[model samples]
Target chain A: MTVSLNDLVFVAMALVIVVAATGVVMLKNIVHSALSLILAFVGVAGIYFQLSAGFIGLVQIMVYAGAISVLIIFAIMLVMDKSVEKTNLFSPNIIRLLAGMGLTFLLFVTLGVSIWFTKFPVVPAEGPVDAVGMLANLFMGDYVIAFETAAILLLVAVIGAIILAKGAEDKQ
Target chain B: MEHLFINIADAFTGWLMNLGLSPWWADLALLVVQWICIVTIVTANITVLIWLERKVSGFFQERLGPNRLGPFGCFQTIADAIKLLTKEDIIPSAADKLVFRTAPIFFIIVSVMLYVVLPMGDGMQIVDLDVGLFFFISVGSLSTICLLMAGWGSNNKWSLIGAMRAVAQMISYEVPLALSLIGVVMIAGSLRLSNIVAAQGNIWFIVLQPIAFITYFIAATAELNRGPFDMPEAEQELTGGAYTEYTGMRWALFFLAEYTNLVAVSALMATVFLGGWQGPWLPSWLWIIVKTYVIMMVFFWLKWTFPRIRMDQLMSFSWKFLIPVSLANIFLTGAGIHFFKWMGW
Candidate 1:
């Protein structure tokens, strides 16, 4: 089969995601790694856009690339000492390396098995889809319990963090 | 008058197709042309905006402003731009080279990308995505990272402090900004900006969702890092904030990007609240420009009138005041929609 423009775009975005994900893992500088993470997030968003999941794509950019990456970088800056270099060290001891390799192999096998066993749905070629509407309905209707549970979980986390912070201030 | 730009674009694409190019190539060429046109318009508009700001600030302070350069100092911004171009580019020796250099470029790119979803006239937008409003908000959020880059890369205490302040302020205000727009989205029943504009054909959302409009205005000002909320680049406190180490054209890019954002946000405000591009006498495109400028004038007025707020005060204002108000507005909007439906109006 001849490579269509869509295939080319998919390949390009896939390459970006792979390269940026690798950079996030391998980059020596924490800030650079964070930036690479942002790139990877953006590439995932592009893939979502390609799949016509516009709402999910925008949310990915907003929550991941925009908010989460900034938060990561801010945490990095706040916690790291002035010595920017040598912040992210890769120590490859035998035990650590073996553990890491085992975890990686396990993850790979799990993902591979899941992909091999899963039956993918074939989407019909149709006019534009109302992704946002479908998502809203799913969240508010059938998955309302799960959605509310996640919201409540986040609220608890926020309150817990606030109380912890305020408790520290009181001690000071 | 309504279909002027659309017709021209169609003719241009047709011309490209007649040149033996495939449909895909022609469309790509059309996209490139649109991008070029957007950049040119943004730059030209910024030139005028800068001059207007100077003049308006002069009016505020009872001064003549830049009258010496050209007629009412219209050419002053142009001259200043040229000077900035000619000035020696300086990078701090200790700076992070890549991030420092890329920050302004990224900032400007993010700012210009905002224009894509803006319905400039009736049936006028670049792509008109289903999640147009969401696209705008999400893309606009990326600019925060650019400021952080500028600050981090500068390798200066002032720059780092400024960037930290900017990130904190932007993150906080972003909540209120997004929440305030939810009311309009609820009323219009769509996040598509063009649909929101269309819904306001009868009555402006400003009247219907006044609380949303006010909260949005406040949140947007904080987002834009303008006066009273400009904690990021408080010159007296942070010495130009994230931009302290930038010089020459590098500094100019940040300036241009800020104005670009100002214009984009003002246009969005016009679209969401003031019935975008809708007027009785004027053409749709001209009407949008008029409404955008009117909103921009209010921005300018607020900037010139208020003193810069303290960082803590700015943060508290967003978290304590604007966020709660916007959440209340959303509740009111939901209740109002149900009430109207129950009344059979």
Candidate 2:
């Protein structure tokens, strides 16, 4: 199989994402986890680029890697110990872990069965890259309300964050 | 996606068909040339920018900038570069050495990457990606990590405080900085920087999105840590902020990155709002230079005009005022676009 350069880039980006996500989970240091989160975000942006979602890729990098990562780092700084300790789950019972695993397995089996049984026809309309144009059209035409809602949601988040941070500062 | 990649690959293959060499080798050659162009432009701009900044700063303070070493201090940055090269690189006694060393290099790379899609003249861009506007913003934000690294690696209280403030301030203003562009993007109906510029062939989006343009300008100023928004490195308060302990070349990297960021952001503003590379009877490249320098002058004026806002005040202003204004601008832009279409004017 002749793999094109884009395919190579896509595979490389996916590998990066997986590795960075693993690092986030496995890294002992909280700061390291935060930094790894940034790496994961960058990987996601790369994937977005491969998908030809240039605007979204940029947003992912700017908001997640740039703004949110910095916010997390600041949060890390505010915390007393920068070291990583073992996280304790409330339930130490083996039965609980077993039940959780059982539920996850059941979900996977059910999803797989449904997908296999369903004979859904692939309605070919446009390629995935055209999703950008489609999304913009929907945003202005049919999904304008939802788009406005997203803007409102971001505004609310900003307000909430400001209040929370300010309330903490006032107490201090 | 496969089809797109195949097309690009096939194009390369066709180009190398005459040479009787494998297309893969031609692809590699193309990549090398692209990278070389990117690197040469980035490095040359950084060097030129450093000199321009020193001269600008000196002129602002009513002093001779750097006329000693070379003509008009043309080689001043070169001399400074040599000094930095020879200076003993010092790590803070309690600093994390690995991140410390990695941070400056990452900072430089991020700043350099900003030039990738930036068009110096008509059809003269390195990579005219469709999402050029967003790419610039995204890559531009990566420097914040380097700043954090500088702050954390210094192991000084001042450095920590500076880094913390910088991270907070930059993140806070990003909301407005980004949201403000929605109005322009709406007016242009595309996210591509080139398309946005082309849309302004007759009347610039700035006329329609004046509020957004101003909001973006102010927010981006804070984002770039210039002047009134420069609380992160307020020497009077934080003792050089995040870079309290950086010396020699590492410090130079941070300095160069900041100025380069200023240039990039200013250039981006020109591209998005101020009729990028567009004017009457002037060459496109000359228009770019004019617009870019004009924006840079505004930055200098901003730095010299307003006093730094309190950190808390900066945060609240962005969250409370700028974000809402930008969102409103976005909505207004949507309505305005529809109305303009209806009028068919």
Candidate 3:
């Protein structure tokens, strides 16, 4: 079959995502790693766009790439050790490198076995999805109980954070 | 009356079709031409706005701003453009060259992408997506990356500090900005910007949801990094902020992006709250322009009059005060809508 524009775009987006994900893991500088992670996030969002899910694509960029990436960058900046400058990114120690490689290889094998061996059936797309409205309905109407539970969970997390940050005030 | 731009676009596209090009090719050509026009308009507006901002600031300080260049100093930006174009582009030795070179371009791209959903006039938007409002807000949030990139790439303490503060301030303020819009969204019952404007055919949402308008305006000001919330580029403290290491056209791109974002935010406010392009006598396009300019002037007024707030104050103001107020405004809007429906009015 001849490749269509959609097929071309999908392939391009998938390739970009793979490369960006590789950059995220391989980059030595934490800041550069975070930037590469964002690129991967955007690429995933592009894949969503290719699926015609514009709302989800936008939200993916908004939450994952925009807000969370900024948070990651902030953490990197705050925790960075500026005094340490190394020419080689990887450690020269043999045992540590082997251990890391072994762990990664294990992960790859597990994922490969799980995904490649599964008998998944493909579902062809019927028509365009009203992502925003469908999502809003799912959260607000159909699964509102789950939605409110998630909100409460977030509130609990916020309180926990406040307590952690203000621990000194409690003692004083 | 029909949209002026639509008519012109139709004429141009029709002429292209007469050249015997394929349908998709002609459409692609139209898209390219429209993009060129949009970029030109954005650049032109940024130039005029930079001059206006200077003049407004000058007037605030009781001085003549750039009077020597041309009538009302209109040509001053043109003069500045030439100088900037010719100026040396410097990259610090310690900088990450790739990110440093790419940051400003990314920043400008994010700002320009914001204009895609903007309804410049009645039936004169680029693309009226179903999730237009969401698209605008999401794309607007991505500008933080540009700041983070510029700051990290520069390898300068001040730039890093500025970027850190800028991102923190922007992200915190973004919650309230988007929340405040929910009140308007609830009232409009649609996420489309054009529909929101149309919902205000009878009256503007500013009058109905005054608290949301106030909350949105304050949050938006902080989001745009102007006035009391202008902590990111507090030149006294952080020098030039994220673009500190940048010079010439690179810095110019960042500068242009700021004004472009300003125009975008005003256009959004106009569409959401001020009954965009909806008036009696003048054309709809002129009405939208007038409303946007007024909102922009209000932004300038706030910028000039207010003192720069402390970082703690900015953060607290967003979380402690604005967030709760916007949430309450949403509840109030929801209840009011429900009450109206109950009464069958």
lDDT of each: 0.91, 0.79, 0.88
Query: What's the residue-level lDDT of A39 in candidate 2?
Result: 89
**Per-residue lDDT over B90-208 for candidate 3, one digit per residue giving the tens place of the 0 to 100 score:** 99999989999999999999999898888888888888887899999999999988988898889898898888898999999999999999999999989988889899999999999
- Interface root-mean-square deviation, each candidate: 1.3, 2.1, 1.3
Q: How do the residues B1-345 of candidate 1 rate in per-residue lDDT, one tens digit apiece?
A: 778998999999999999999998998898899999999999999999999999999999999989999789899999999999999999998998999999999999999999999999987788888899999999999999899889989989999888888889888889999999999999998998889999999999999999999999998999999998888999998889999999999999999999999999999999999999888987899999999999999999999999998888888888899989999999998999999999999
Question: What is residue B306's positional error in candidate 3, in angstroms?
Answer: 1.4
TM-score of chain B alone in model 1: 0.99
**Worst 10-residue stretch by lDDT in candidate 1 chain B?**
B122-131
Where in model 3 is the C-alpha error above 4 Å? Answer: A83-96, A99-103, A106-129, A165-172
Q: Measured with DockQ on alpha carbons, how good is candidate 2?
A: 0.53
Best candidate (score: lDDT): 1
Ranking by DockQ: 1, 3, 2
Best-fitting candidate, scored by DockQ: 1
Q: lDDT per residue, candidate 2, B102-207, as tens digits?
A: 8888887898788778876676566777667777777877878878877776768898788888888877787788789988877786777788889998987778
Q: What lDDT does candidate 2 reach at residue A18?
A: 90
Question: Backbone collision count in every prediction?
Answer: 0, 0, 0
